[model samples]
Target: MSTIDPTGVTLVIGATGTTGSRTVAQLTAAGRPVRAASRRAGPLPGAEPVRFDWYDPAGFDAAVTGADRVYLVPPVGDPDPAAVMLPFLDRARAAGVRRAVLLSSSAIAEGGPAVGRVHRALPGLFDEWAVLRPSWFMQNFTGTHAHADSIRADGAVLTAAGAGRVGFVDADDIAAVAVRALTDDRAPNADLVLTGPQALSHDDIAAILTDVTGRPVVHHHLTYEAQRDRLAAVIPPEFAAMLAGMDRDIAGGSEDRTTDTVRRLTGRPPHGFRAVAERELGAPAASAAAVHPESPTGAGSGGRLR
Candidate 1:
């Protein structure tokens, strides 16, 4: 739908992820060809699935072939995504790829965190590039993460972000923005902060879940050390500490903000926390949680808060 040929394949990295899957669906529905790249590429609804891994260079050429655009998901756990992505980006540029969209977190800045490094370098690598700095995904509450299990089993949501609010955005909304970023004739060429329509505290979230699920849900506020210790059982200690630190920052109201970028870019409003809760929790607990990846927040992300 851009100036580029409509038939030119768009390489979608992490094609089966939270946002990636939705992006692929939207693009394909619009009659665009897509190369859905992932570690275990399988049959998708309307695209070609191809095996691709960021750490593997040998798989890059096949995925990039005849592709004019790409959606990037930086390698998690890698301190420098640029090291892993820059080479492939150069290769894509040489192969006539014209646009790129990188998925980043709102908490990460242009020169700050791991994705931030990639965000700073996006423009220079490709003339048309947009960085999506989305806030913590609402999926963290419904999907396979530290919160979902406890929420399902104990009817409780735990966080160190006591009373601190977050403008949790929906993954589907993020995907719609990605589709535009990859297909629009003119790129925004800037870092866009994506959020839900409103901000809500963890307590508000628990209340919403309780109302929607008709279950007695409670918000269990944990100390920073306790949050870190709980996560340490699953992920690395250093990473758990890092997540706890971010949670502490949240307690200070770090993520209590909303934006209109989603509506401005996608011609639709982002999903509110209430809407997310109703739709996700409106279903049976097991069914709703099954909609997410096995582990939406392990490591290599901002924190389990994501």
Candidate 2:
């Protein structure tokens, strides 16, 4: 528990999603008030649920009302989220929101792509703010995410990242950092690069999966063009291309480094890939042990990434 009780009602956007949910849980556990905002307003144990949508401006007033801090999860599929989010943030600032925290990717930079646009303008928008640029998530391998079903069925993880290693950060660590940032009196008014303790390649991920799940999971490396083509069918062409390029960068060692931001913020080192795999996937794979298929991986549902 924090020695200082952080002030204000925190308005958490995407409260039902990955990092947001965990953030809300931590704040409530700390005895801080939270305004949980989502597309669907649902009952929460220690929060005030409000209906919210980034595309809908009508809800902005109620969402930010009496809320001094916000945890922003910009709408996905908007190639440029700044246009939609900036106006809302302006309204939020006008309504007395003093701090904000954005969920961004390690691959994104100022004006680069996706959350990068928001990242560039964050410091100027709010007096106290932080943009979390996290590497790939470990949840991708355990939950019903882009790679989960494929791994369950095919015993394989397809990637354009040939042998590029990534320090896959756990979502729980991200939530811990976010909650601290949201309520901290002295803001970390900077872009924080978060990662796990060590980096591992897709082949390494497969080996861990095999050991945990007791299945012969392997990594199928694809060419950039091939990977882009595969993703294009599910997501927009431009988005698919961007994702493929990210993979290409990964393959080139862009995300090989690890950071201590997680430990710095949460006062503990991050969970290693193998540890996360064991905690989240080991139990499930053991209950239903069987030989899986060999299906080619494709983007599934274009799920909202945190």
Candidate 3:
């Protein structure tokens, strides 16, 4: 629970989205006022729904007005989001919004690329701020992601990351941390890397899924170009290339570590892949059997982690 008393509503962009929805739920459950912003402005039980489009600046004022804080989820599929986001943020700053929490990716660093530009500019835009650079979401395997699709259809996890490990964190944990960042007496004022309790390779993930679901599952490795081409069929070519590049980087051991950020901020350990799998996958009689720990290791429908 936040010790700080929230005076104004927290504007939650992408309210119907993965982390956005969870963040809104957590906030409302904590008795905090929230304004849920999405393109459709879909209604949530305890939130004020407002229409907010990244390209539509006309609605920006309505969303920012009367809100002291903002949770930013960058526009999906935009090659350069800072171009759209920075302007709205400037408007938000002028509107008296004091705190901002941004959802970014561990793959990208401040001032590095893509949302990194927004990550770099967040501090200058708000007095209190936090940039969450989380690892790959565990929901990718259980949600409406490509990985899940492959799992359901072909009983396999496709990836270019051969033996590379990733500290896949849960979206629920990410939202919990975001809620704290928004409601805490003082902002972290720094970028935090969030991850699960432990790192697991794709092979390990396959084993866990097989154990939980009582079905055989395998990790089908693909070449970088192959994965890029496969992803390009659905998303933009450049973005597909970028995602494939992240996988290649993962293969090179880029996302091979875990952090205590989630525990440090939320006062609880992050959820493991197996727990997420059982809860979200709805596998009957999901087992808690242990698997052999090995090495490391998607673009899914849940949108890029960034």
Worst 10 contiguous positions by lDDT, candidate 2: 295-304
CA lDDT, candidate 2, residue 210: 86
Better of 2 and 3 by lDDT: 3
The best candidate by lDDT is 3
Expressed as tens digits, the lDDT of each residue in 29-65 for candidate 3 is 9999999999999999899999999999999999999
Candidate 3 minimal-lDDT segment of 10 residues? 288-297
lDDT (C-alpha) at residue 157 in model 1: 78
Question: TM-score-based ranking, best first?
Answer: 2, 3, 1
Q: Which segments of model 2 are wrong by more than 4 Å?
A: 1-5, 284-304
- Runs in model 3 deviating more than 4 A are 1-5, 283-306
- On TM-score, the stronger of 1 and 3 is 3
Evaluate model 1: give its TM-score: 0.90
lDDT against the true structure, per candidate, is: 0.81, 0.83, 0.85
